[model samples]
Target: MIQWIIPLAFICAGIIAGLIGEKVIFKKLKTFVTEKEVPGSDIIFQALHRMTFVWFVLAGFFWAILGSPVRPDIANAFQKILTIIFLYSVTLVLARLTSGFVNLLVRRTEGVPTSLLSNLAKIAVLILGTLILLQTVGVQITPIVTTLGIGGLAVGLALQDTLANLFSGFYLVISQQVRTGDYVKLDDGNQGYITDINWRNTTIREISNNVIIVPNSKLASAIFTNYHLPAKEITLTLNVGVSYDSDLELVERVTVEVAKEVMQEIAPELIANEPYMRFHTFNDFSIDYTLYMRVSEFFDQRIGKHLLVKKLHKRYHQEGIQIPFPIRDINLHGN
Candidate 1:
């Protein structure tokens, strides 16, 4: 019991000191620094917390080794304490540096790249820490490294498709072919605006406000149309039919004028150029005409087309132009 007393006292003292430090020292430090408008109070708090952990670890180490057969001399004990403190200091510095590095990388890139870089940094730090701990515990890591290499090869082979998608996601970010907020049409006929590009998939928000998650593997392999790239301007064509009795020149002039007017009224900024009406085909019921116009954006085409059609209907009715309806004539032979 007497032998255990010194060790127990050391531990009790450390705990009491830590409590006091947290309550008194830390509080005073916070107040002083805050009153002075210091810039790094948060960092100081983090360092203090780390130092408290160091003290606790050191106290336990001393308690465990005090009565051992290999008990160190006073000078040796002091040296050992210094070494422990040094190691703790080194670890703290390394941790802070690694954290700063991760934050810097995260701030520099966005989307998939930032995620990848941050994850990679964390994994590297963990691996380095494990290696250092192993070495400290007198374990040789050569065999472990070799085994990990072999295991990694097998894992890579097993997860080839997954890795491919990951790499493809990175490629997409680097190439800037598609990004959030771009309107895209997938090969599978899904059309939507890109909401997010993540590690494994891209999220798309449809015009109906439904969200769709598309795997990077499928996106990388599929042919997709990005409507927001190259330019936002797009050509939209509306097919209309008028009765054959309507004058061709009058039809073209009225259609063009109506389209331009509607575009100007609804979306004045969307009209990239003057609208034109073209005679496309002669159908069974009426003459098919195409109204071609350039809009500032693909989405505007929908609204522009709707408004133009409504205006065209009103104008055609006012001008007495007949929009022919399909009719089938049947002749029955009397038996």
Candidate 2:
């Protein structure tokens, strides 16, 4: 009974310490982090939450094991196991911390994929931690590394497609040709905004709210147009035909006025490059030309066109400008 008191006391102490650390210390730290608005406070708290209590409990158990009346060999073995567990937990926390920070950094920079780089950072930390853990347990690393090098070749050969996608994802990120938030139209006619480029695939979200998952290798090699690159501004051309007898100068002035009004409403920033038109073709019944207007982005063209057509049609009516319909006259001679 007397011998058990020390071990029992240690166990009780561990529980108490764990409760205090988790309930009191964690709450205070979280409050501080929130109040300070630290750059990575959310990440730090997320990685460390619930871990404090476990660590304190583990520490208590380790001391209790040392004070217990157990065989020397058995005690040493238990201590070793506890050390491994503690080290592994620490490794997990470190991995999370590194991964979160990497993602935050990538988000701050333009044209970099957050998921891909952050995942890679986490993987690297985990691999390093694993190697350290193995060495701590008296396992020789040289032979293991040599084996992995030889086996890696075989694995790489077997996973050719997987490797291709992985490398292609890296290329996409580094090239910066295609980036998240860019509106792209693929060769296959699939148009969407890029959401993310992960290890295996790139995610695109269409205007219709449908998602497209294209493999990294395919996306990298595929012919695509990135409307956001070079510039987000694009010219929207509307082909219009008016009655042949209509006054050309009046038509141009009225059409341009309507276009400018619509553009100002839809995208005011593009007003510097005012809307214009040029007569291009003469038909039997009407004169055809293109009215060119500027829009902010690819998606804005829909609303811009809608507004422009409504305003142009109303203004044309008020100006007595007639939009003639296709008509053909036939002459028949009886022989």
Best by TM-score: 2
Q: Give model 1 RMSD, 1 decimal.
A: 7.6
**For candidate 1, lDDT tens digit of each residue in 1-335?**
77766666776776777667777787887888889877555545654564664566566556646643354577466546556565646565555555545545444553223444444455576677767766765679999999999999999999998788778777776687887667899988999988766667778899999999888778877899999888777787998899989988888888888988877875578666888878879899999988888777778888888888788899999888888999999999999
Candidate 2, residue 216: the lDDT equals 97
Off by over 4 Å in 1: 1-151, 330-335
Error of 2 at 121 (Å): 1.4
My TM-score estimates for the predictions, one after another, are 0.58, 0.89
lDDT of candidate 2 at residue 283, scale 0 to 100: 83
Which residue pairs in candidate 2 have backbone atoms (N, alpha carbon, C) closer than 3 angstroms, thus clashing?
none
* Cα error, candidate 1, residue 54 (Å): 16
What is the per-residue lDDT of model 2 for residues 145-228, given as tens digits with 9 covering 90 to 100? 999999999999999999999999999988988888889999999999999989999999999999999999999999999998
The CA lDDT at 150 in model 1 is: 96
Query: For candidate 1, which ten residues in a row score worst on lDDT?
Result: 110-119
> Per-residue lDDT for 188 in model 2?
99
Segments of candidate 2 deviating more than 4 angstroms = 111-114, 330-335
